[model samples]
Target: MMSQYKSVFKDETKLDINYVPYKLPHRDRELRLLTEFFSFILHAPGKMAQRIVIAGDVGSGKTVLSQRFGMNATREAEKRGINLHYVHVNCREYRGSLFLILYHAVSVFHPSFPKRGYSAEELLQILLQVLDEQDAYVILTLDEFESLIEREGTEAVYKLTRLQETRVNKPQRLSLICVMRNLKILEKLDASTRSTLQSNVIHLEKYSKRQLVDILSDRVSLAFKPLTVPEDTVSLIADIASSEGGNARFGIELLWRAGKYADADDLNVVTPECVRKAASSIYAVMRKSEAAYLSLHEKLFLLGIARFFKESERAYASLAEAEQAYAVVCEEFNVKPRSHTQLWKYLRTLSAVGFVKTEVSENIGSRGRSTIIYLPRISAHELEKELTALLEKDV
Candidate 1:
C-alpha cells in the first residue's frame, strides 16, 4: 500500500508545507499591480515609482505580496537597464515622529542616515538629489504604515508625500509604496493630500479554503523533496484555515506544524490525523506564545469575556456588563483595573490580531452605537486556558 502511494506523485518522500511563496496563484493580479505602479516611473523623469497603497487584513499575504513586487520589479528593472533602488520598512516599529522616520528613510538609500543628520527637509532634499544623481527611482515599501498615522499623526506622512513635488533640476522623482492595514483610514487625510498620493490601491481579501489549498500545495512543491504529503492531509489544512477565516498564512503555518508532528511520530506519510492533531498541539502552543505578550490586565479582561461567554452561553455581551465582569476579574487577579476606554483599546488590538471579532452596532445603546465584540477565531474557554498557561503570575 505504501509503495503504491509512493507512485502517485512524480516522486515521493518529500513535501514542504511552509509558505515559501510563489506567483503561480496570483500571477496576473500581481503583475497587473506591478506594471501599473512601474508605468509611472518607467517613463516619467519624475514620479517613475508611483505612490500606491496595498492594504489587507493580517495574514492575508500583504507583506509577502508586496515583497514579491519589490523583488520582481528590481530584477526586471536590472534586466532592462532601468536604475531602480527598493527598500522596505515596517513603520510600526520605527514610529517616533515624522522627522525620525525621514532620518531613517535616508538609511534606506545608504547606511548613513545619521551621517546625513540633516533636518527632515534636508534629508528629503538629499534623497531627491541622490535619486536625480543616480538617475534612478527609489521605491520604499512601508508596511503597517497606518500605525504611523495613529502614532505620529498624518502630518508626517503628508510631509513625506510633499517631497515628491519638491523640484530640484526636475520634479522630485520619489516613488512611495505604502502598505496599510486599513484603506478606510485614508479618509482621515485631507482631500488634497489624499488625492496627490494614494493614486492607486490594491486590496487583498483573506484566503479561502480553495486558495489556501493551492498555496499549500505549491509551497510543498518547492520546500520539500517529493510526495510525502497525502491528499487528505493537505485538504485537512484547508479546512482548518477556512474555519479560521481563510488566512493563507495560517494555513501554511498549520501545515508546517503538521509536518513536524508527523516527523515526531516517526510517520512516513503526513496523514489527515497527523495534521488534525497538529491543529491543537503545535498551532495552539504558538498561539499561547502570542497570548503571553498581553498585559496582565488585558489577559484578565479577555478572561472576563471568556468566562462570561462560557457561563452565559452567548457569543457577545454589552460593554456595561462586560465592564462589570472585567472588574470582578481584576479583583480576582489582584491587578489594577483599567478604564473602559483602555479595555476597548485592548479589544481592538486583540480583534486585529484575529483572536476576537468586532462589529459596529448602530445605536444599540444610549451612547449612539458601540462595537459589538466576540471571540470568533478563538473560544472563550480555550482563551482562558491558554492565557492561564502563558502567565507565570496571576491573571
Candidate 2:
C-alpha cells in the first residue's frame, strides 16, 4: 500500500518555511544595504560595536534577509582574516529574558557554559572574554526583538546597545542585527537608544505579485519535480497571497499545501484547483476558530464589513460605509446598534485579532482623512457565511 502511493515532491524540505534559500528574490537591494552597514567590521574587526534594525511586516523576509546577510558577511570576513561568528536567537524562544538571551549567545561559543549562578552582566563579561581569547567577533541577530521590548521593556535594548560601555577601550566584539515586525516599538525607547538605532535601520517592503511569482517559481524548481507545478498554479497562489499584503511566506505555504493535495490524489501535476482547495481549508479552519471568540457585537460588526465588501465588490470600504452596514446588520438581527465611538473600538479589536484590516487614507479633495477597512486573509463571502451561521446559532 505504501509503495503504491505516488510522490511529486523532489525534496519537500525545500518547501519548509524555515528553510532559507541561497538566493532570495527581490531582496538584493536590502542585502546590499546590510553588507554596507556592517562593512566596518571587515575593515576593523573590533573598532566599535555595530548595530542595525531590520523592520517589516510579517512574511516580508526580514528574518531570511538577515540570516543570509550574516552567512555571507561571515564568509567575506573570514576571507579577509577576521574571526567572526554569527548567532541567531529568537526573542520569543527566550521569553524575552535578558539572562537567557545572553546565555544562549554565550553558549554558542562555550556550550558547557553554566546556565545558572551567573547574572546577565556576568555572562556578558564571560562572552567577551571568550571572544577575546579566541580573537573572534560575533554578529548576533535577535529575531522578533519586539518581544524583548514588551517583556523586559527598553532596558533590554539599552543593555545590548551599551555592551561596549561595559568594557572601555576594548575591541567591540559583538555586532547586533535586531529583527522586528515594525519599528513602532522603537517609540518606547529613550531618545539616545532610539538615535543609536535610527541611523542604521533597514526596512523591507512587502513583495509584489510578480515578485511572489518569481519566488514561488524558484521554490517549485527546487522542491517539486520538473513541470509538476504549472505556471497557472503558481500564479494563482501568488494572487491569493498578494491579496493579503503580498506575503511571500503565505504563497510558499499555499504552494506546499497544494503539492500535498496533489500527492494525496495521486496526481502528477498541481493544478489551480488544488491551490483553491488549500486556501479554503486554511481559511475555513482559521475563520471558524477566530470567529468563535468574538463577542456578539463584534461578530455583527464583522458581518457588516463582510456584507459591505460583498455588496460593493470593492477592495476596501470607508469607516462611514462600514458603520452603516453594521447598523443594517444590527437591525436585521433585531439588536441595538452601537454608537460610532463604540464601533470604532470594535474596529480596533477586529484588526488586533486579524479579523479585519484597517488603513487610514487621505481624502483626495477633503481635509479629513478616512479609515478604510477590508478583510485580509479570508474572502468577504466566506466571512459573511461563517458569521451568519454563528450569529444565527447564538440566536
In candidate 2, which residue pairs get closer than 3 Å at backbone N, Cα or C atoms, i.e. clash?
A: none
| TM match of model 2 to true structure | 0.73
Ten-residue region with minimum lDDT total, candidate 1: 5-14
TM-score of 1: 0.64
Residues 1-395 of candidate 1 have per-residue lDDT tens digits of 56432222332232332222447464458557766767655555453336787877776777777777777777777877877777777777777445566556566667754553456667767777776777777777778888777776667677777764546457545677778878887777887778866677778777776787887797667554477776666766776676677777677777676677667767666655455556656444336667777777777777787677657645356777677788988887677789878988988877777665566666745668876655544545566777766554643
RMSD of each: 13.1, 9.1
> For model 2, how does the per-residue alpha-carbon lDDT over 1-395 read when each residue is reduced to its tens digit?
56776778999999897898999999999999999888889997798788999999888999889989989988998899889998998999999887888899888888888778978878878888999999999999999998888888877788788889868888999889999988888998988889988888999999987899999999999999998998867876776788778889988998999899789878899865566557767775454778988999999999998888777645567899998999999999999998899999999999999777677778998898889776655656677889999999886
Please identify model 2 stretches exceeding 4 Å from their true place: 1-3, 285-395
RMSD of 1: 13.1
Overall lDDT per candidate, in order of appearance: 0.67, 0.86
- At residue 64, what lDDT does model 1 achieve? 78
